[model samples]
Target: MKRKKVQFGVMLHGPGGHMNAWRSADVPSDASTNFEHYLSVTKRAEAAGFSFVFVADGLYINEKSIPHFLSRFEPLTILAALAPMTSRIGLVGTISTSYSEPFTVARQLASIDKMSGGRAGWNVVTSPLEGSADNFSKDKHPEHSLRYDIAEEHLEVVQGLWDSWEDDAFVRDAGNNQYFDKDKMHELNYEGDFFQVKGPLNIDRSNQGQPIIFQAGASKKGSGFAAKHADAVFTNGGTLKQAKDAYKDMKQKAVEAGRNGDDIKIFPVLSPIVGKTREAVRERYKEIQNLVTVEEALAYLGRYFDHHDFSQYDLDAPFPELGDIGKNSFQSTTDEIKRRAKEDDLTLREVALQETTRETPFMGTYEEVAETIITWIDEGAADGFVLTPHVLGELYDDFLNEVIPILVEKGYYDTAYETDTLRGELGLKFKENRYTQKIRV
Candidate 1:
């Protein structure tokens, strides 16, 4: 069978792509806390014919550097405000299964989908950081395996709640003193290992029945959960071969779990710092790098992995042997760095810079950047990409004006959005509930 065409999305945070993105002189530093900044970016994305925009979430700030990382509006609240501003792009917001209740999450997501006319998406995450657990009244984070188990149950309950009120369940008929068709409403009464949720959700079913479910997990258990439930999966593989391998494995896992392999879309995050010329791009990258303080990088790293005392390492010297960082906490990142260094014959300092930043070969002329994305798509490495702009609005503007036309001409991207609803744009058909089994008397 012929492969499907690639889809595209943009991942947005404070001012732009990553935590250090604010350092870019062109990006407004205060945009992280400014609602108008978000609105501006959203308008740009919608006009560009982009598929969606995503906002990530975290529950707590790092104890060591609270000042640097803690100033952004909550994702769901921001997305709710964004719902009415745009007409076509999907609005995805992350919510932690480890900290939120099933019913509450279901209600919030459904409400946003309704408010957006079916353009909401939920990115389910099982946070592994310990600080988040402390905020949730737990002294320690749960084991990774146990957390995945809870996520599985949580997702099932949420889906059940979303389906409780069937389409046409509410008649709003007042003449006959009948407000609803009682038979059309069903009770979930879900009893599971991690949670017990009873009955139908208080809110009505969304226009799309449920919000699109996005998952971002790459570990063994994480990949499994994503294959079984995610409408789309976000991953962070740095090489084409690695992305292809991961995508193939995920599809196989989905098939083994009795799901259609094509049901789950794989999107890898690509942070491209584009410019009109290679020299210009390099100059821009250097400017952004200069603004990153060691303190800020270390603060961001400590939150995601082991708490490294980066202050001790010389800025010009090679990274010291990472002998003390917790194996479970930083193993994947360390392994990736080591592999890339050996394969590319890069120095330790260069490896550190690459892993800590977003500057890459994708940062060149418009033709060069577009060619790189087309190459990746043709390689069967990903269904599409989640573009992470290094500077607020600049990368997006450049892409829309310079690169989108090329993609459209090559028949690799859409010239216009197919529908206002996210589900329709994503090619998801609304199907009748198949979980209900019939009894043969």
Candidate 2:
């Protein structure tokens, strides 16, 4: 894969990503629902030259769900609302293929692309929680592999719908009374196992023709879908070696799927704790960790295991034995937690705290955090990063003010917004309409 400039995306979780973030005095009580708060944060990110702002979504929630997940704006709706407000920043939102119809998802995303001048991205997801099926009025959720099969067909139909109209299809001419070129219009007429969409979409293509496709693929089946379809991958970064292995595997899969290795950029999540000094950073980290109790940590860990009650286990005993509890939901993450707990001989309480406040790779001064980021990208461990503001307002502000400038001086980042579209900012080529390609051939 060819080397490219590192990119950054800010992942927003209203008050913060931490479980006890809402308890902090610095955070607004209604930050998650406050449109003004969102607007302010996005504008700051845009000004700081971040590549995009990502909004994660989940359909079903329970009493045990995290604070941020319990109450948050829907992804597509919020992204659309943010489109006209900001000009250059990309808007990426998560929408599950399991519950949503391709036609509706396609139209909503395409509308955002048009509204943002082609600065839209869709993070394709298969609703992992089994309870999601209940909310959708389905008897049972599709199993892991079956969900990917549906995702494959769902994405194909959506991309097909995007190519409904050719690039020069619209020709508004009052004198000739010609609104659009009829020959350029084409119907998808797609008939798949999961979906059967017909005819051209009502909305025309956007500036980039299609919205960028993003997927978070950790399992075998999930990664295969992303390798073939996604333009970028949002992943979790474990360690330098672990990240490198995943990076290499993803690039190889993309090549085997008949795409350039560089076609699908790999972005692992970067959640750093940055402060003015090492002492200050350690103090802040400890303060944040103390916010979440042992019970809360157990609940947070249970979210990956289909909400399995971890409170029943003895706090001082070894990690419980659950053969395949989390294979369907967040397989990679669950597997890692189990493997690490067993390998390190961690007690139940130890595992809970460690998992809750997982050690951040970048924890120190602002300069040190910047250096770690450069090392990760330069070492082929990552192409870019999905920056998670673990403590919303405070951490995010520090990163944009202190760390980003160091990155700029070191040639790993730039502050100027030269492109209007997300694809251009990420150095990805515009997708040409399939109908237009047929005409040229």
Question: Which candidate number would show the highest lDDT if scored against the true structure?
Answer: 2
Encode model 1's per-residue lDDT on 103-214: one tens digit a residue: 9999999899989988999999887565677898887877777888899999999988888876777899899889888887888999999899996888876666678899
Quote the lDDT for 437 in model 1.
Answer: 28
Could you give me the TM-score of model 1 versus the true structure? 0.91
Model 2: weakest 10-residue lDDT segment is: 1-10
Candidate 1 whole-model C-alpha lDDT, 0 to 1: 0.76
Off by over 4 Å in 2: 1-4
**Which digits, one per residue and each the tens of the lDDT, describe model 2 over residues 93-148?**
99999999999998999999999999999999998899999998899989999999
| Model 1 residue 376 distance off true place after TM-score fit, in angstroms | 1.6
**Deviation in angstroms for 14 in model 2?**
1.2
